[model samples]
Target chain A: MLADQQFLRIPGPSPIPPSVQLAMGKPMIGHRDQQAKSLIKQLSPKLKPIFGTEEDVIILTASGTAALEMAVVNTVAPGDEVLVLVTGAFGDRFVKICQAYGIKVHRLDTPWGEAINPQLVEAYIKQNPSLKGVFATYCETSTGVLNPVKELAAVVQQFSNALFIVDGVSCIGAVPVKMDAWGIDILVTGSQKAFMLPAGLAFVAASKRAWNRMESNSTPRFYLDLLRYRNSMQNDTTPFTPALSLLFGLEQVLRLFETEGMENVFTRHKLMMQMIREAFKAHHIELLTPEDAASPTVTAVKPTDFQVEALRQTLKKEFQLTIAGGQQQLKNQIFRIGHMGYCSPADVLQTISVIEVALVRIGKQLELGKGVEAAQRIYLS
Target chain B: MLADQQFLRIPGPSPIPPSVQLAMGKPMIGHRDQQAKSLIKQLSPKLKPIFGTEEDVIILTASGTAALEMAVVNTVAPGDEVLVLVTGAFGDRFVKICQAYGIKVHRLDTPWGEAINPQLVEAYIKQNPSLKGVFATYCETSTGVLNPVKELAAVVQQFSNALFIVDGVSCIGAVPVKMDAWGIDILVTGSQKAFMLPAGLAFVAASKRAWNRMESNSTPRFYLDLLRYRNSMQNDTTPFTPALSLLFGLEQVLRLFETEGMENVFTRHKLMMQMIREAFKAHHIELLTPEDAASPTVTAVKPTDFQVEALRQTLKKEFQLTIAGGQQQLKNQIFRIGHMGYCSPADVLQTISVIEVALVRIGKQLELGKGVEAAQRIYLS
Candidate 1:
């Protein structure tokens, strides 16, 4: 039998809603035309509430990594010192990008499945008073660790010169992020994550403080230049011919989020996280991230007494549900289940039940339907 | 009545085929899954014939300009001498990208509506023997001027150390490009043009010589790094989460091209160019580029009597057919009609007929059906 009914429960390029997919299939329009202008004008303001920022949110026609690069290149100049708080793979990426641009990086390293301590960041800033910025990942998808971004932001604000930059790729839309209220100088996200769209568009919101640093920073940049995006936003357009199909999908997705209310959207994701965690706990599985620091969008579980790859294959071959393997150091030791974007309680229920069977098939000897029952109880409650 | 039956006759984000559209709407798959690997492996080799290269073709999830930046950043280092042959806006962009990287640029300036003379390029290289690279645009979309890339490549090959890099964004698929045979060291193109897909993917093909140069060039790069892409492609994957929907659409598009044959695809585009030029001549309209140097993909027409913007607006309002207006200096002086990718003889005929009506409606007296008659004659012959 053909495995045609595929379910993508990975960290990103998440399951696109049918309406968004239909919207993407709509015919292309001129990127510089009035129709495109009107669509952009309508879409930009709607994105602000999702970002929880009243500042400028620039849309770039690149991946999430490019947005992260923009956040670094536009804010810090060469010879400038910056602090990179590493909890997982993405935080290391920020350090690499900053180092590539000749910035002096002071890394605050944390274990893969743990959150960064905001107190440690404050202590580092106190000693390294010359630092220009501090980079943090709100959700480290690799280990499913949700960092304490609000606390981190508050700590960064204590240093007058250091700008707080958050890589919110896998968390922004699913979790609550108050960019303005939390005083995040720069916040970045991608469309493929919780935006319920395909991979192509990346967004970055910047406060005035970030813009001020950008004006003084002299990094050689072209494609990821935020100033160009800001200038084009005034005319309700982009600096490049945007991925119009994805933008159309984004418009539909934003409308769906608005209809459901942002608070309810966050609550739904939180519930999915809770249900998945409860289901795994009932199966006697241990999560990689500590319970208090686990991401609302993705859950990483340790593969105890069973081959994670074998279970993943069984799930793919028998159930047509695809999840993610661990990255870097944790490879083959853990597996990740993503419940972001258009994932529903039903999706969580199906995923849990299938994992239960796959675990037993892979010689884990887990009780059948026990995990499903746990998830059902959470859904019911 | 609704303007539901719309046609995009613009330069890019061209009319996506129904099959491609349907393929794009297929359910999402894991970026690192076996299914995705198989799809990517199946798709990459098919792209080689269109690119006319037997070398590495790296795919990036960004705009065409990003691919151009990659071409520059990989092949040459800062303080290296490079010749930027300017045909129009995109050529100027190449110059800016090079200059942004601190490359010493020797600009061979051509006017907005003219092609770069290969003899002039040869003379420049003869004078400047220390040039590390020569940047040229295969097709300038802004002015519809197709550069003499073959002859220019021949001239650049005479130098032992210099690399011939061509920005083939607008002409790679629509026009015949023999990258290996033409001695092109690096070639770049975007998906939105003749690939018959949405805007999200960019492609770059590199030769062995370019790879050698990249190893020694020390430019700070991460996301657009060719070496990273090469490393991942060995495993039939990308270094990042690709725009999977566009790849699915590309698979169908490549299949369609294979069904039609690559030579026949090029021939069809050439025929469309001929018919469009003949129709414009029948309307007593002058083309922006001289007959010998015009691009087969897009036709730029100078509006002698009618307002170009008014004619464009009328076409959109009355027939829902969107074409392109002039960019920068050519604004209001010219209009562009793109016949690349999925455009047929009938599309050309209809576009000409509508242009005739639009011109007449905007107070420029033109013979009805005159342009269409010219195109139809070419089609019938």
Candidate 2:
């Protein structure tokens, strides 16, 4: 039987705070009511600092992926040439969404665990002068690798006509993404990941540059039509019905983050990432991505001569742990632990302790106490 | 000033039942965890009955409109000819989403308060043999008109190749939609409506016939990709991160409906619609739509020569009542009272009383005692 209760492990939709959950429990409001308008109005401005841009941040009643779709559909018209940086699943998704809309996508494919090379991207942009847009992920959730968005944005700025769309789903609220200063025209994020809420709504911030392109774009869009939202945003309302309960939950969490300060949030994420990385190393488990490029949200580790699948099952069955297996071809080859929103240092330490116990139970040759001791060192440090 | 603490008195995000609210408050679980998968698996079955289809239902983390877009993009490709029956705002949206994808849409425009004529739809299909699909709404939430889906489905069935897609967003669970029996290829609904949960997730059920078209159709879709969800649904999960809390809330609501039985649920909605209609007549307010075609979920009324907006505002301020305003050009000309999902005769009576009070407050010269009397007669009847 699967572990039936208390799923505190595993990243995202990661433990929603009690207060946020309480907010969701509030009575549902009419999506078109003036109250709903005020809520959306307040939320839009509140999210500006989160994106590090004064540009409009519209909340779509969809997932992070939908925000990415909104960015793709709104930016590129039919037959528009685009450059996509592919490192993991989400980047590949961006490529696919672009292709789906009949947009020509040129992918700068990188190794699964590696980050996109800024120089390579610049060269590609230079070569493909007709490229209408560039899509990249700030943090590749699939491999826990962070692309150098600042450098990539600089290259994109050189192509004044091309829109730079960044899927900051896993990166926003965890890392600093300066949409305005970085010249990122479209930056998208989801509430579930870094916002520390349940997945439902996606946050998108668009510069006027992107809006200019949208004015002339001929692609058919209704629900995620940024223009309708743009018009509605002028009056502090949305075109279609919004997710009010989720908006309330988002407000509570964003306020909590504001009180905590974004810099402190980023620093805390870094500390958590370091704690997990150091623990894996001491336990002789290899980190998949290089240290410099590792995502602060999740850490993927390769086991030392053990059946990762069996170990994962044993961890779930015995210790009630719920870590993630590698996606697609990497399945059973790597296990990932997410130390994202609402996860504290004690969470990191305890999760490591459970992994060490599971490892020893699975007869993983040596290093019985190594992982916990390593994690304890990070906790104290 | 925006009305603060005003309850959303509209049909949905329908009051977020305390049970569903408490369910939504449950801590967020890992998207990949067995706990989440269990929730999804449980939800997948529950959604089928609601969709009136035995076919697989793909759950997207999006609003009702987002699901509508998913259905359009998945079923119809660019340049595909589609017949859209526009009776209300939602039908117009269907046309817009279709046109966005470069699908040529022929609108069978009906008056806003009127339902689409089934015969007209059939004639349009016959005239345009090249038309690949017919898009219509089961319940036009805007005008409170329920279109002739069964009749339209009967007509569309004559053209085996033309897919019949129904936006069941506001009608599902409140009314009967027999997808298989009615030949509806694609039917979409949202959690916010009859499901009595927050607005975030939209559930779509695709017939095998729709799947055949989706298999060959090449309109760009990555986020709302039905195929990805179709393939993933085999494993009882979604391809992207879902709104897990909403899923929990949906599970609780579905269970409630099951315990109550579908027939009883439909009966409740019918009774509520009756109660409201009687009240409107007693108030001497003309209904915008015909009683025969009125939605069981909502009632649209042409308020007596009075400031309809002011009355709605007063209702919110005084009675803590919330109702929907007319959309598009109809705004301020008509007001809609929703009586769907978790609303009973008492809720209908309370809404009627508030409307009467607000009418008097705004000096709408009408007999004050008649409205509640009519509602009482209907409730007793």
Candidate 3:
């Protein structure tokens, strides 16, 4: 193992790019300075494109979970009914946040490692005509399943007036999300994921419908209050002291997105997803999420021939490459690989080759070069 | 003007030491990695001396405001009667956060430029006898007044069983805070102030008395939940993704505090505060706070002969130096000089000299070198 390098391959808190690192390390500046105001003004418009919305994107110095709480507390009041589509762990968080605030939740659970069916959502919406809000996760990080957010959004709008909110924390920057065009009322994401920065900042963009609900809704809140953020953005700054270093890193991350072009960035993620999935298939590994429901950001694999922990330990102990194991119930049953944010197709190839060697070392029957060759062929295509 | 250099003399977002800056710029690491756990384990104990507490100091990936919110929601439920001592703008924020969460606030407002009288607090505690919590600010950044928290704690402990929570945002590290021995139930601080880092992380240390209160409280909170943080610290990690870059900076900051022992560090801040106050006295400028009430971290000065805005502009334009003007009601009426964390005796002298020059340029009657000479005498003494 190399002494100086650690390959961070988690789904979120992904690898930070070099230029973004340099930006974060720059000397601190006054948050109220004209330069800070300029950074704030430039950031909102630049971020709108990634969110696929023309609405102002509110910047918060908080974790992605705070953004999820903001979504719950701002629009829906306590005792109000809402529907939560639970595909995985992140979606369940919405249920918890809502229930914590006394919002009655009508939860619909999809099988693990599978996407939510849009027809089921339509049926729920039809049954609960008075549901004030509908929550969904765009990319479920736990099971590596990408739900059809557009289809689900269409279903909500067609059947009911419930405001549609999507937690896009794991895939907003890597995928195409038309929040404005698709009638997604509110979309939330964090910097640690695809923004290629540390985990201190979260972004939220809201439709006018969401804002109207917030104004009329009298949920008691302070820090997670979105209207305070909206009022501060009018002056081109944050309501409280901002995370200046993260903002510095965000400026550079935005430049990276622009330089690559949003379309190209999306294409790269899709390509890496294809390469890794094809490689896993060649190794005869049991994939957790079916190919049709797989998320482009992360993929789950179940190794039946050898212990999953043994394979993971071998990879970490030998190559210093880290992959996440399944969370909660999936623990000891499946291992997950994250290939998003600052990740690349080259990283995918390198990871598959290392896994192939690791499998052989763990006494699993596997051809050493087969996985690498499969990924390479897909990369060339 | 030098295009590359700017002296940030503001109270917060302070000038980072070179070592802390370099530490923050280090490459990213996984939040769930063994190294990350090691970091979390190291940070809490090192922070105990700063808070003067034996309890675990919870690290949060948020601005200081979130810590304040956490203090409110965790211990006191809505409709619980609490006494908030409003010494300045920050104290008013406590009132707002309380009222927002439907907590019944019995606010006591002190004059803007003076500290709260302990006698008044003792009397109020005797009258109410049943307040569930008493909130106070250690350093009022808005007015540069240092509240006598030790005395306040004594009063709270003597008369009532109310939990005592302190907002030590601006002065916890520069001064002294004994959360445990002082009978303080909770103390909150932000990294941007005396921690010598960027504004992404906030720390909170709580007494067992406060935790007992939280165990029975039913206020709804998710993101700023203190119990989740306490549980996660047991596992040597944050419940959510942490601000890894800021943690890197904090490790370096702890080293700085240790290298210059805690007592010596406090003495340095005392010296800076004395030097600046004596300099202002030499210039015959008006000081807003009484000598006994002045904060070691920041001092507010009101200039009657010259516009505060003009002096601030002259300093910025001529020397690229930035100091804060008064906030809210005192805006354009006073200017503040901050001398804490990463600041030195040399910086105080340089700042005094620059202000002397700026005073003369702004057509105020001030002899050159008078302020600098006065500060020099204090340093030598």
Pairs in steric clash, model 1:
none
Model 3 ranges off by over 4 Å: B1-381
Backbone clashes under 3 angstroms, per model: 0, 5, 0
Tens digit per residue, CA lDDT, model 2, A124-225: 888889888999999888889999998999988985468999999887988888889989999999988878889999988899899999998889998989
lDDT of 3 by residue, A14-87 (tens): 98876787788788899999999999989999999899899999999999999999998899999999999998
Instruction: Provide the lowest-lDDT 10-residue window in model 2 chain A.
Output: A1-10
Instruction: Please provide, for model 1 over A1-381, each residue's C-alpha lDDT reduced to its tens digit, 9 standing for 90 to 100.
Output: 111236788998898876788898788999999999999988878889888888878889899999999999999889999999999899999999998888999999999999998778888899999988999999999999999999999888976479999999998889998999999999999999889888899999999889888887899898988999999999999988999999999889888887778887788898889989998888788889888999999999996788889989988875567999999999999999999988766567557655765676677776555665566557546
Q: Please give, as one word, the docking class of candidate 3.
A: incorrect
lDDT of 3: 0.87
Any residue pairs clashing in model 3, and if so which?
A: none
Over B1-381, each residue of candidate 1 has an lDDT whose tens digit, in order, gives 111246689988788876788899888999999999999887778888888888878889999999999999998889999999998889999999999999999999999889888888888899998999999999999998889899999999985369999999888888888999989999999999888889899999998899888888899899989999998999999999999999999888888887777787788788788889988898788888888988989989996877888989987875667999998888888998888887765456557655665677678866554565566456545
> lDDT per prediction?
0.85, 0.81, 0.87
lDDT of 2 by residue, B275-361 (tens): 788877866789999888999999989875887799888877655678888999799989888777876554555466556656767
DockQ of each: 0.01, 0.01, 0.01
Q: Write the per-residue lDDT of candidate 3 for residues B199-313, one digit (tens) a residue.
A: 9999998999998888888999999999999999999999999999999999988988887788877888888899899989988999999999999999999988899999999
> Where does candidate 1 chain B have its weakest 10-residue lDDT segment?
B1-10
